[model samples]
Target: MNTIEEEVPLGRRRRRRYSVEFKAQVVAACQGPGVSLAAIALHHQLNANLLRRWVEQAEGNERFLVARSEVSVPSAATPAFVSLPLETRNARTGEIRVEVRRADQSITVSWPTSEAAQCAAWLREWLA
Candidate 1:
């Protein structure tokens, strides 16, 4: 006979340590095509917010590694966006604007709506 136990999120539970391999796997899965972070986290039995934090850490580490102690980096990571207090329901449709420069040309692209997952995926691919 097989018995299954349900997981319960306890209050102030003990800290769990994840291996580098496991973290890498989770990060990669979260960045995979058509894969949402929430879905990946759920599938791996992880907290979605924790996974997001890991992604931020991984991205920062990746940047440092790429620089290889040659290039200087800022002391603080700047915020990618700022909040606006003014609000208008009669405003134009919102779009996430993206600009990419390569070789001698620059291209700007905009995506309609606030589709964060799609934006993240596009940015990852474009930067890679």
Candidate 2:
């Protein structure tokens, strides 16, 4: 008599545990500016969406969330900088200025500040 082996469900596949340092590295790279989530995921041979989910979990922890909220929270004493307008006119001259704005003031710099704002938005949305 021939016997057929039962197929295991996809969800039952073994779950892998990443090292703390490795996970931190992935999170750091994900948090870094000008680095696309897709690129980071691809560099690690992972799905972009999965890395995104991991980011959500990491940011959800109480301590981290609180710390982030402090920086992003719109307070009477603080201003919220939403985004950095990309300067296309001076692309050839490398004259892009990263606009850091709050409710009260704004400053321009040579590097992009979108990373912090984007991360805050992601966390806020997750919380909501």
- Could you report the Cα RMSD, in angstroms, for every candidate shown? 21.5, 20.8
| Local distance difference test, candidate 1 | 0.67
Give the lowest summed-lDDT range of ten residues in model 1. Answer: 67-76
lDDT of 1 by residue, 1-128 (tens): 11113334778665677655566656766554556899878988889999999778878897523433343322333456788898643247677677788999999987766686798898899779
TM-score of each model, paired residue for residue: 0.39, 0.37
Q: Residues 1-87, candidate 2: write the lDDT tens digits.
A: 111134446877754555444554565667755559898789887778878986887787765444444443222233558898895
How far residue 35's Cα lies from its native spot in candidate 2, in Å, is 1.7
TM-score between model 1 and native: 0.39
lDDT (C-alpha, whole model) for all candidates: 0.67, 0.61
The number of the candidate with the highest lDDT is: 1
